[model samples]
Target: MAPSKTVAPANASAANVLSSVVNSYIDKTPQRTKLIDAFLGFLVLTGVLQFVYCVVAGNYPFNAFLAGFSATVGQFVLTVSLRMQSNTENKGAFEAVSPERAFADYIFGSLILHFFCINFIN
Candidate 1:
């Protein structure tokens, strides 16, 4: 007869690993990074809700829905790019670009994106 292997120890090990990872992220990540992450989360939620509304409501005003969804996706992409450039870990990758410069770029890009989105809606 094969000996039975208990699942409890394995489950506990997995839980421990996950807990440690979360703790590390919370402790080591900078406040600015956390703020950016929060904005990213908001964008993701907005996009998901827009998609669900489009699907359920049939997008009668399809252009408006498209513009809103596009803006969310574009903003998310820009924010991620900014986060990557400004992150301490990526300092070497963006050696010449300071965090302030990265933020300026993000704002400029966002303005352009919104302009086009608004034009599309109109």
Candidate 2:
């Protein structure tokens, strides 16, 4: 008779390792990073909702769906860029650029993204 393979213990150990790693990370992360993480999570949820809507409603208005999805993705990208640029640890690398400039760039990029999304949606 062939031996039976037991995977439960391996799965449990993997889950435990992942949980500990996440817990450690959460404990060490700064409040600002936590807020940004929450924002990113919200954006992901919004994108998922848009995808579900498209699936349920049938992409009759394909342009609108494209515009919405692209906006979500663009915003997420811009937010991540802002977070990276504003991080204190990256000060040495971004010494020449100020946080205000990074924020201004983010705003400019967002405006450009919205402009394109609006045009494409029409």
Candidate 3:
């Protein structure tokens, strides 16, 4: 008789780790929330500034612009994802996603973004 076999689902560990980390952040101090919010505002400001500078600077070094833009966008995506994944009061599809998994997804997406940016720049 053939031996019984089983395969674990991919990302099971990721889901578990993500869940725990997100839960821990719940009920954090108001100061923590304020700090996070302030940081995000800074990111938005940076993006706007960079965009304006790019427009004035012209696309002469299109490659450099692309790389810098990609890195900024990656950071933006990561910050937003962290917020969505860590919100305890958030109910709906977002609640089901673990913070760790979201982070991993954010990281993977950033890598892909960078890959394209690198090619465009070079």
Candidate 4:
């Protein structure tokens, strides 16, 4: 008797498929986008570290924890917005807005976030 062979579907999802997709995406993505991704990742890591510290040492100063975490989160959000605004592909969507304007908005937002964080900390 001959052994039967099974064929996989063309669209079959494999364990390594995600890695391949991510690799391809990274390869094709612009350098600016990659930089933004790295920055966002750093912000997230900082926030995570702050949380871990608070947990380990106890949130003795809850306001300080909130200030640090909020600052990280706020920076991440503002940076993401800057990325979106500065993206060439998104230029059409933001036809009325310029890169300079986006940067200004980022600075303004950061100032506000910093003010609140400082107030909360105190």
Question: Best candidate per lDDT, number?
Answer: 1
Off by over 4 Å in 1: 1-8
lDDT of 2 at 48: 98
Worst 10 residues of 3 by lDDT: 25-34
lDDT of 2 at 106: 88
lDDT of 2 at 111: 98
> Candidate 4, TM-score vs. the true structure?
0.81
Q: Give one digit per residue, the lDDT tens place, for model 2 in 63-101.
A: 999999999999999999988988888899899889899
Once model 4 is optimally superposed onto the true structure by TM-score, how far is the C-alpha of residue 88 displaced, in angstroms?
A: 1.9
Instruction: Pick out the ten consecutive residues of candidate 1 with the lowest summed lDDT.
Output: 5-14
Q: How accurate is candidate 2 locally (lDDT)?
A: 0.92
lDDT of 3 by residue, 11-60 (tens): 99789888887776565535545566677888888888888988997878
Query: Candidate 4's residue-wise lDDT over 1-122, tens digit each?
Result: 88988977656656469779899878888987898899999999999999999989899989999999999999999999999999988999999999899999999999999999999998
Worst 10 residues of 2 by lDDT: 28-37
Q: After superposition, how far is residue 17 of candidate 4 from its true place, in Å?
A: 2.9
Clashes of 3: 2
Ranking by lDDT: 1, 2, 4, 3
Q: What number of clashing residue pairs does each candidate have, in the order they appear?
A: 0, 0, 2, 0
In order, candidate lDDTs are: 0.97, 0.92, 0.74, 0.91
